[model samples]
Target: MGNNQPTEKSVSDTISDAFQPILETPILNIISEIFQPNLEIIPKYSEPPNYNKEVTNVYILKLTDDKYYVGKSNDPSQRYLDHATESGSAWTRKYKPLEIEKVIKNASHFDEDKCVKEYMSLYGIDNVRGGTYSSVRLTNAQKGLLTQEIRGAKDCCFRCGRDNHFADKCYAKTNVHGENLPPKKKIVQSRININELELLSSETSSD
Candidate 1:
């Protein structure tokens, strides 16, 4: 009886231990797989955001003669297109197909408005505005004429009264007679020396 009891007890205890190990092995594996300290599980969100701002600058375009169109813009290329396509203002509409001569950026920073105003005042009011007729269009001749007129009005020169001629040919000069007269004295120092030498030689030969 004691021997049978010992065998049954040992078998029952062995089976119970085996069942516990089977159940606990899977649970342990699941817990380890799910709750273990994983370094790669959390997603990283480390990317930079984007931002930008508008910018302001100056632009210039060349016109006929010495004239130009000065303007301001956030984008110079866009502003240039706007002027040509009549997109923004009446000025562009009136002056279609404006030829861009040059572009001057940051003109506001350089006091461009003051410079343009001064240029207009010196060149004449009409110089800033384009003429109505093709004949009146700003030309190289018209530019020269305007420059002459401006200089004449200022009484800048006595010769041409405009900047074309010099002071030597000045019609306003009072020394007209002096201008055509010959030089005061001839340079005869070399001639005098030669003559003295010849006379000394002739005297020595006679003696």
Candidate 2:
């Protein structure tokens, strides 16, 4: 008697058999005819990534629109993936980075500072943010400047340019009296006599 056995199908054969009928069916043709082509074209995939992707501390992100975010991370690729998944920095998620614009070779935060400053200058301060040391320094500097501005306005008289009192309580309310002798006493006065009026009202009510 001759030996006989059934041959096993290959993976290619199995897959072909499964999809061959679907490919040959007229339903695809019917569907194609029934529906108009989609108006939106699928964008081509991004170019091949840099193979030498070392985790440099600083990276720039190009927003989907007109904005930028400079950042630092040990694993920039993973950080990017986090951004894509919406679990990364709130800025990156909100703006939606189109791509990692550039990865700095240096891990120094000073370099990050330079990048952040450049982006802020180019795109306007409102449009850019991030970096480790840069963020802190910028924030501190901004806060300091704002505080100084506030204090300067409060500590000097706009009318007389005196450092003793505010403009609202200045002796020379409207006069640009040039820098002269400082006021001997604090100008503890207001345009409205609220306390006197309130005192009069209280006395009248009591009477």
Candidate 3:
């Protein structure tokens, strides 16, 4: 009850609290405003350059003559226009392309190959020109040569230059198209006609 007055902090106590280390201070879930000296800076993620190619689509065009052409492109509309104008494919030009019937987006060449084969099976191989691979083209040409043979035509295959089962069942990997095959040597047989022989005899008798 004697000298009831509020006491103030001592000068030495205030000085010691002011000089305390910051690490000793209590904190609640606070991050630093600046980075550490030894920290590594990571760059943000970026897309690839061939991202468009990776997301390209496999599509099918329905011709006016009930045929189908399977292909791959990122822009199906432009590709369809090219086919409609008769600038895309020989098959499309011959059959008159109508419109795009199907489109499988984000497709690869392998996916295109499978789609083409499926279309070929659905609408006979002769009606389907199929995909744009070397194997597909070579196979179609071989089938054409086989059809020629079935029609009694003496046309050799564009691949091996042979008329028999060479083209009918050829499983060649590349589209050599008779490039590596040996050149065909022509056979000429000279036969004397009856009139020519009689004239020769008369000339010999007169001589």
Candidate 4:
């Protein structure tokens, strides 16, 4: 009788057999997913970006009316979008079909204002509206000087020559006589006399 012993499979074949399901399962799952009916794909939505607040930029936009508008905003792209989509400003609304022509980033607010004003001058004062371009925005010092000029009035202070303060409040007037002092304090004796007459009349009426 011939000795018959079953030969064991190679170690490599066993290892391959063990890993076959592991490798093939994923591929089969992928194929099933592809061929599956009514497959709903979950949309991959990215998170919205944070808005940049410190984007001081000057922008120039051209309108359908063949006019260019110079303006400033923190975000020029968003501002342009607003001018295009949002029907807010009358100028933009009337003009319509607006497009951004130029952008100057990282500009000072004052410089932006100056640029807009210069553009307004070049275009026409009536064509521009709002912002410092329409009115001069003065600094605190400039405002103070303006206040002084207004207070100076027609008659100027001879002492300091500063118009902001009245002559009575003037430092030079402090030493001056009656003219410098606010009109003398007058005691209204008439009121007291009227009160006495009223009391006397009431008393007489009671008698």
Candidate 5:
């Protein structure tokens, strides 16, 4: 009779076929692990730092009287408390319960002074004080004198002894009402006298 049992080669082929699926299972798992969405949780990204956070800032406060106060402070919150308690400037004291309208942070004194001047320009020079305000108006003669005096000046003001401003333009030299001292009549008289003397000298020289 022909052999009814499977041949050795056929048995080996059956074993190989059975092991193929088993070998493929581990490779399939590896591929799924590589391509599968990550199951491990990851930490969320953090928010960026706020560069505009107020530190040594310029702030504008709207007051109860409908006026505005422009101020500069390293800590605006503390300054606000001073203003609310009437320990601030006279202007802020008169107009109580100020609310901060805007803040400009991370600025130098020059920048703060610039902001204050801009606010003054928009609202009115009298809106705020104790910082830079409207520049004092100089008469032609006063400007001439100021120019002459400042030709060799290491500093600005002769009156307030400040560096960057002339005597006539110094706010500290102003009266309590913020008006400049009346232009010295003595200087005017001296100028007129000198002019007259020059005229007389010229007439004599012509003769």
Candidate 6:
């Protein structure tokens, strides 16, 4: 006859194993509670900053006429308002009134002056700095010629200024051309000869 029995761990061993899981569970829950909110808030501080600086230089166009007004200012909005007012300068006064069609902003002082000059030149206005228009009328051919003259003056090509050959065939490269030719190489010539006496001796022996 055999007795049926169940193997069992000690009471202390059971308590120890259960106590470890209970201790570890509370630790994991506490760690998760502390870290989750920190992860959520970290992204908010990492965003980029925004800048809203205002532009200062501008171009004003008249809506009703062929005239365009180009000028520079530290404050473009104020300048435009002043130009539209009743006490504006003689140029704006003669035009009777004006409307701004376009505004170019944030140009350097030199660039602003150049832009104003170019625009005045295009519209056949003289004394661009003071907004003075000349009464002298230019024919189309004359206008084209004047434009070319101004452009040539601005460019001031050396060959054109010197009245020499054009830029494409300037003499500056003449010395450089002489230096580029291939250096000379020496060659020796030689002649080859066969002796008639040796050939005759071999032929006689063979016979």
Question: TM-score of every model?
Answer: 0.31, 0.38, 0.41, 0.36, 0.38, 0.35
lDDT tens readout by residue for model 6, 1-207: 676676688999889998987677788786887776756656556655432243456565462356555665676667767767735455554453356656666755455546655665555433232222222343576544544554454553233222344444444432221323223233578654468767988999999
* lDDT tens per residue, model 4, 18-101: 999767778878788788876367566898864444447888887775666677887778887787875435567667646787
Candidate 4 — which residues are off by over 4 angstroms? Answer: 1-55, 133-207
Q: Which of 3 and 5 is the better model by lDDT?
A: 3
Greater TM-score among 2 and 3 belongs to: 3
RMSD of 5: 18.2
TM-score of model number 1:
0.31
lDDT of 1 by residue, 1-207 (tens): 356554445887888887986666778787887888866987888866532222246555545455445566667788778767768444445555456545554444444454444354454534453212123346776655654554555555433343555545455433222334333334476545888899999999999
List candidate 5 segments past 4 Å from native.
1-55, 134-203
Q: Write the per-residue lDDT of candidate 3 for residues 1-207, one digit (tens) a residue.
A: 697786788998788888676546544322443433444565667876775556678889888778888888879899999988878887787788777899998887678767765665455556777565323245666766444443333354545445554554654444323235444444699998999999999999998
Instruction: Name the candidate, 2 or 6, with the larger lDDT value.
Output: 2
In terms of TM-score, the best-performing candidate is: 3
Q: List the residue pairs that clash in candidate 1.
A: 58-106, 62-101
**lDDT of the candidates, in the order given:** 0.53, 0.67, 0.67, 0.61, 0.63, 0.52
lDDT of 4 at 43: 64
Hey, what RMSD does candidate 3 come out at?
19.2
- Give the range where candidate 6 is weakest over 10 consecutive residues by summed lDDT: 127-136
Pairwise lDDT winner, candidates 1 and 4: 4
Q: Which should have the higher lDDT, number 4 or number 6?
A: 4
* Deviation (Å) of 94 in candidate 3: 0.5
